[model samples]
Target: MEYHPEPVQQLILCCSCGIAIPPNPANMCENCIRNEVDITEGIPKQGTIHFCRNCGRYLQPPNYWLSCELESRELLALCVRKLRGLSKVRLIDAGFIWTEPHSRRIKVKLTIQKEVFANTILQQQFQVEFTVANQQCDDCDRVMAKNTWKAVVQVRQKVSHKRTFLYLEQLILKHRAFKNTTNIKEVRDGIDFYFAQRNHAIKMVEFFQAVVPVRSKSSERLISTDIRNNTSNYKFTYSVEIMPICREDLVCLPVKLARSLGNIHPLVLCHRVGNTVSILDPNTLDAAEIQSAAFWNNPFSPLMNSRELTEFYVLDVEPLGPTRGKLMLADVTVARASDLGTNDTTFLVRSHLGHLLNSGDHCLGYDLTTCNFNNDQFDQLDAGRIPDVVIVKKHYPGRRKKTKRRTWKLKTLTKEQDELVARKQDLKRIEQDYELFLRDLEEDPELRANINLYKADDARSVMTNGGTDMDETETDFPEVQLHELMNELDINDEPDEAMQ
Candidate 1:
């Protein structure tokens, strides 16, 4: 089958070395545009563009979109909601809250997958084995630990090694929120974007509340999205007191709510009497204002704004992007649709991303154990410290009695694997040395040793040391004695002239 390229639209384009922006005719994005900025008095130098989502700096190949920092259970829950958005994003009837980002880590023999029973059914989980020389941190990255997982949880889903491979058939991309506002300093994750001291979202909410004209409810306004002169326009009536949503309340929603909205602000409005909400953009809405619109315009605004209402939370569990409706990683095409806000509550996904994020691929997940390292430790090219699995939970029930069996796998480093890894490291070192050796030969011929430096995958084409052309074979010279040449003539002339 021929693969057809999807037409490009509002795709965020990044040059090889800058913060990405929406593509421009210049064959570059904003980072490139900023490069053209005329510098006068000490503008800060641009830093490299690193994607907020995953390991890759840009939204490039191989590295999937950033996975949610949230656990697989929560991730799966998010994925399910995104899938369900195909119909509508009604409040989820079932709320399977995941533990915190940091879960407990347990060390166990990982040769065979561990099987455990949850509610008399089988489930699968993963345990990653990590070793640290007892290095301690004041802030442990390990959310789960020895005491953290004292009691095993029977996650509702069953995941198998084979199934893990199966689920990877498509990538369950992580979601990222891109703030297109000109103010970089004000841009922040989730709630932080709102409540900024100098932002307009708060004041705007207050102003909106003051203008609402509610016929029956005193300054209250009712808004109906009906056609005006054959044009779709929001009809409005008004009310009193725009009770904005508090910051703490918005953050309480699961991470999936953000993902469901395509990392865009959620449209969290209440259809009480008046008001509408949209996402922040170069063109419109303050995401920080979502709760404001919902609170000020709703008939239940008074009840919701009371400190007592703090007990309940409302979050838009859909990604906020431009599409018919979905959260796909594929770029947005239509420019106008790119600016959906928290009030719109409509998320759009690309077909490619839509297919990849489907529950079939990233459905159930088992977590790896803990690692003892700082988050900043990965700056160098060294192998990243692998954290062991603190705990794992299956997302669903197994198909059969055997498949229903709960299992967790944690593999210990074997003598062979450990040795192979060491050898690979050695190989890397050798390669570096070889490059230096070649540089020495090129810069100063006298530095050349008795070796033909040619193309060798290892380092150089030395006849000895297992070079590519000739595999070193001590066996070829059977009569040669190992280390028997201490008195060899090669050193005979070295000290003779100097000592005499």
Candidate 2:
């Protein structure tokens, strides 16, 4: 039947160009159709991407801050979503074109297909150039403007030194616990963290509860109320008080509390302070943990801290071999460093740090022979029950040597100082506190495990001069191993302006 023919299908000339094509909508040749109907007509060739320099986040319109890396899928999607006329066409492909990172420019190449007339589909590819314009985000603006906080966290510790605060600061830096804070103010006794939202402050308080033995209490004040909308705004304040006891402190616990902790000695050394106060009897090496609730119920400040430590020359160390964990019972002969040249006086005492002491090595201990105690717990102890000297930690010499620059460093948060002008004494105090922190890191293996240490950019400089990162002649402190440090590029998820 077909042999009689479907009348030879007629071909139509292109409307714009004299080209023949099968009769269909948009009767034009492919080149003419592409030139006449552009699928990317309404899309702009250039756009602006709002960026927050303070936070390193891109502003998605309508007040949303998004964190996306350059050339990432999330960033590409965000860039495509910024285009106005893309909805009219079917998106075929979208990708990023590499450009100078510091140039603050982003180029996205887009391919789209759209139907022009009847079955004629037109596809086009074009690039959109986006220039980053710095704009302060809501959070950053609040930080610049004082007193814009909805919640405040005041961390206080009634201590003479800032050693505990420094430790807490390292923990916060390692965990990024201050990420949501709008402002961090260093106060006289402690730090104050301000947050735009109440939940962020709550999370910080919870973090403090987990990291340190602290008692926290919260209070809220009504700021404004809208009866019509059934809405009310309240400002919240969280007060966190850390336990006064710190690492390497001497404690004279109450008789009742001492008996409760497995009948351990009341006279103990603060081994390490964390969520709980860990105390070890220097005589017996008996360890116990004091919880936050228990500590606050009957809190007592340390009788003496590391500041009271006196250097002693070790004359002898005889290990009795009664070991508990890393500690061993021993009879130690020691003379005060000050008395070594003048007198022949010596004291024999039982110590828990017997395994770490050498005959010629110097160590720090608490001298109770000449000191008088005023505490009720100490008064209750019989004079014969108290030891003459309590060994605390081994002393490392050569700290007086030139302060060689470090090969590695830690990252700290940007904080606001409560003091408008730092006094010389304050600066000196800060330096001393930092030195103590460094010594703690070198002496205590457990403390170093909780923090992230990054290799500094000038790490190779020290090696070039000293033949090693930390030369034996330069410093006697234990070297921080390379395996414990992380390369900046390996752990950096956010884009740094300096790097860009």
TM-scores for the candidates = 0.12, 0.81
* Shift of residue 394 alpha carbon in model 1, Å: 15
Alpha-carbon lDDT, every model: 0.24, 0.84
Off by over 4 Å in 1: 1-294, 299-322, 325-356, 359-500
Which lDDT tens digits does candidate 1 get at residues 306-334? 11121101111132344322222232121
Q: Which candidate comes out best when scored by lDDT?
A: 2
Predicted model with the maximum TM-score: 2
Consecutive 10-residue window with the lowest summed lDDT within model 1:
169-178
In model 2, residue pairs whose N, Cα or C atoms come closer than 3 Å (at least 3 residues apart or on different chains), thus clashing, are none
Error of 1 at 488 (Å): 60
User: What value of lDDT does candidate 2 attain over all alpha carbons?
Assistant: 0.84
